[model samples]
Target: MPVERSRRLESYNLADYDRLPQCTNRRRLAAGIATIGPAIAEPIGRRANDRLPFPPSTPVGNIVLKLHQESSGALNTITSYGDGYVAINLERHEGSIIVMPEGAVIEWPVSSFEALAPEHFEALVAAAPEVVIFGSGSRLRFPHPRLTAQLAKHRIGVETMDFGAACRTYNILMSEGRRVAAALLIEA
Candidate 1:
């Protein structure tokens, strides 16, 4: 039989070390103290004065960060698809449909590529998307240029792919915050 070795860690009380000076570099300490002026002033809602002197050794660069927050479930995204149906935001639709990045899904009247007409693309134009993704059922196919002339008139671009590829592309475009619409034809 093998003997087991105890692996318990020895703990030290942190209260004993609280009185010790945290930072050893005097110049760094002075720079940190200098920067704290703006931090303390901001909470009181006062604009910080730019006249404060910084340590000459510290290098400063003009860098700005712009942040935009979006809720996870807010956008209407194509989540999954198959031969007979496409799912948007986890809800499955069996017929042809048009989906935009951040709005309700629109039911496209055409069920197959043969049924597409100039007016069939009008829904996409009304949505004013920057790009349109055309998914032609189970295989890749291109629609006649005249059918998409309305989109071209508005300078909106159109991309055609198979049903599966279109669903994948729509999700990618939606995540990028692009004005994209997917016209999917489910033929099964």
Candidate 2:
């Protein structure tokens, strides 16, 4: 019988790792870091010990990986299909991993700006749009001034708000077909 493939891989830029085999059934873990290429190999290998609790066959595409480490807690919530599955550190720590297909509609609630890295910020900026809004989780503190200044220089308007409100606003705007993106850091 022939196997069916999803549209997710249709546009995958395998050009970067053309040498990597395309076998879907190959055990991702056994294939080791070599299969994922140099750029993402190390990070993915390091996290192998904490692989997602779900079955390996779970389909993932266009994932949004968020990392959070706080004194209060560490949690990882993977949201997809309008549902979230959470994984937490049992020893009073928290971490989470969320994997969703590209173009999955989501409303994320965030409270802090520190969860995201510089690469994430750069990608958002390069997208270039009329406005860019950030949901700073529940906190009202401003983002690094340098980031704000960079956006201003590009003539893009920036807005910051609490995580819950940001999620609601981003959803509403997206539903209206607006060009928008958000970085939210909600508790697990």
Candidate 3:
């Protein structure tokens, strides 16, 4: 409804126009476009149909991959997530993983917070992310202080959340160009 916050799409075809509410700012649409819905009569703006859709990889079970846009030396974004996996840049990986900005996805062999060991965190220390998103499966859980003490000594911060929040936060931080990592546990 807000004119300033309309989703700027790369390509808005007749089918796309057919899906919108009539009260929307139809005047903001590109010129020369066909009538989309019964209410859409004329085109509105210029060069609105020349955009390309970003293929954010969606998760399919445990392993899947798709084409994604280059991050321009940025860290990978979490495309989507589900009960047992998070899709990173069109690639769906299972179990636990260490996702870093500027590119490195180290598969961590962890299933749950109860299965975490000090050495599991040691891998993160070696990865040396400035901030870590520790996703404790489907629920909120925290690791032992000793497990993360070494990272604390290095001034590295770790935020604990559920798996879903971890995925979203990871994407936001990566887009911001932050030195962040996601240690996600997507199992019971």
| Best-fitting candidate, scored by lDDT | 1
Error of 1 at 24 (Å): 29
The lDDT, on a scale of 0 to 1, for candidate 1 is 0.78
Name the regions of candidate 1 deviating beyond 4 angstroms: 1-71
In the range 112-140, model 1's lDDT, one tens digit per residue, is 78988999987688789899999987878
Q: Write out the backbone clash pairs for model 3.
A: 10-51, 29-45, 30-45, 31-45, 57-90, 75-102
Residue 167's lDDT within candidate 3 is: 88
Task: Looking at model 2, report the run of 10 residues with the lowest lDDT sum.
Answer: 74-83
Per-residue lDDT for 182 in model 1?
92
Question: What TM-score, to 2 decimals, does candidate 3 have?
Answer: 0.62
Off by over 4 Å in 3: 1-74
Tens digit of lDDT per residue, candidate 3, span 126-179? 777879999988889889899988889888999999989988898888787788
Q: Where does candidate 1 have its weakest 10-residue lDDT segment?
A: 58-67
Tens-place lDDT per residue, model 2, 1-188, is 99998665444554635445654433543354344344444565436534453333444332333445433222222222111222122221122221121243233323235555444455556656556657554456567767567667778777787655655565556545566665544445
Q: Sort all candidates by lDDT, best to worst.
A: 1, 3, 2
Residue 156 displacement in candidate 2 (angstroms):
2.0
Mind sharing the TM-score for model 1? 0.62
